[model samples]
Target: MPKQKGPIPITGTVKNTTYFSLNGQYYERRKSSLTAAVVATDPAFAASRRCNTVFATAVAIARTIYPQLPTHKRIAGAFGQLTGRVYQMVLKGMDADSIVTAILGE
Candidate 1:
């Protein structure tokens, strides 16, 4: 039998600094506290967000079906290809929901 090896030590820098202000007055640094429902219904983010949600759901379903595959790269490639086709369909004036349904088959 081969000799056992010990675990290697990990070395990294530890920074102790507060990069963000907790004060509500700093608009630029402030992050949105919007909930998922609010974001889903918001007109400004609706189209882009809907597309992202649909694409993500599709990829998740695909990953579930093929769990042995490296899903990150596969999902990324699927998203790119699906988005390209969806973009073309959108240019021809197709509704976002219909496009998502067609691509996802639901």
Candidate 2:
């Protein structure tokens, strides 16, 4: 008899499923589920995904901050300018506090 081929078996437990060892070690396996809470719900992630919640909120914030830049292209340009300022600020300093504050922001 010939063996039938099928999809390869994977070793890890399924996502969102809790996996714990009889010993205390395997509990870390569920870290993604916990971390996904932050990654999945972050405002930047929502904005990048083009979610209405983020877009509308961003537009409102931008309008309040810069009433002259009512258009989307102008708002995008503002974002680019802000990003470039942030990049220059970080690039000018090499200290740990500066780098951390740059990446994490004040």
Candidate 3:
């Protein structure tokens, strides 16, 4: 992936900001207080949060399942690719459980 010139600018006020980068895409800064309200009232936000949770869990599981791998960079790169593919499959209406099971060879 190509590097960006700088951090992507986000519009609007946010509090308790945290930054996350996935597959070269940076997530928007989150406001902790407003996040609770948005999660409660927004279907899209809820789905996105659920998806992030699932991917985070899957990355942890993958680390355990493939513990013998060498190097932190390699492990992170592999999981990053795995997460992106799994996310795409999920977005395409595929079952995430099946995708993870297949990836884990379980």
Candidate 4:
């Protein structure tokens, strides 16, 4: 049974809880069990597949030119920004080589 310390309160872990808030609420977080295979093969995760495709394409381009980028404590931040912008372009069905040219000016 849940330990209810106040009116309209439900507390305590029952099962499969990933996260919970002390403000009289609970959240089930899927911290594990979601593998790449699950995302790729599950028909229910079609949206995830599409999103992943866009981001992957962006990262592929970013990686090819990453070593040429200036180094810094927050170097990954620039990579992230590049990936995000490229992701949007990919979602719009832009060509890969054109994306490289647009981002790198070459």
TM-scores of the models, in the order given: 0.30, 0.20, 0.36, 0.55
lDDT of 4 by residue, 3-85 (tens): 33454434344565444455556444444667789978999999987877778888997776566555652354787887788
Residue 86 lDDT in model 3? Answer: 64
Alpha carbon deviation, residue 67, candidate 2 (Å): 15
Name the top TM-score candidate. 4
Model 3, C-alpha of 62: deviation from truth (Å)? 1.8
- In model 4, the worst 10-residue window by lDDT is 1-10
Off by over 4 Å in 2: 1-74, 94-106
What candidate 3 gets wrong by more than 4 Å, as runs, is 1-34, 70-76, 85-106
Please name the candidate that would achieve the greatest lDDT relative to the true structure.
Answer: 4
Q: What is the TM-score ranking, best to worst?
A: 4, 3, 1, 2
Candidate 2, residues 48-97, lDDT tens digits: the string is 45545444444443344344343664554776554444445434544434
lDDT of 1 at 16: 31
Model 4 lDDT, residue 37, Cα: 92
Q: Please give me the total number of clashing residue pairs in predicted model 4.
A: 0
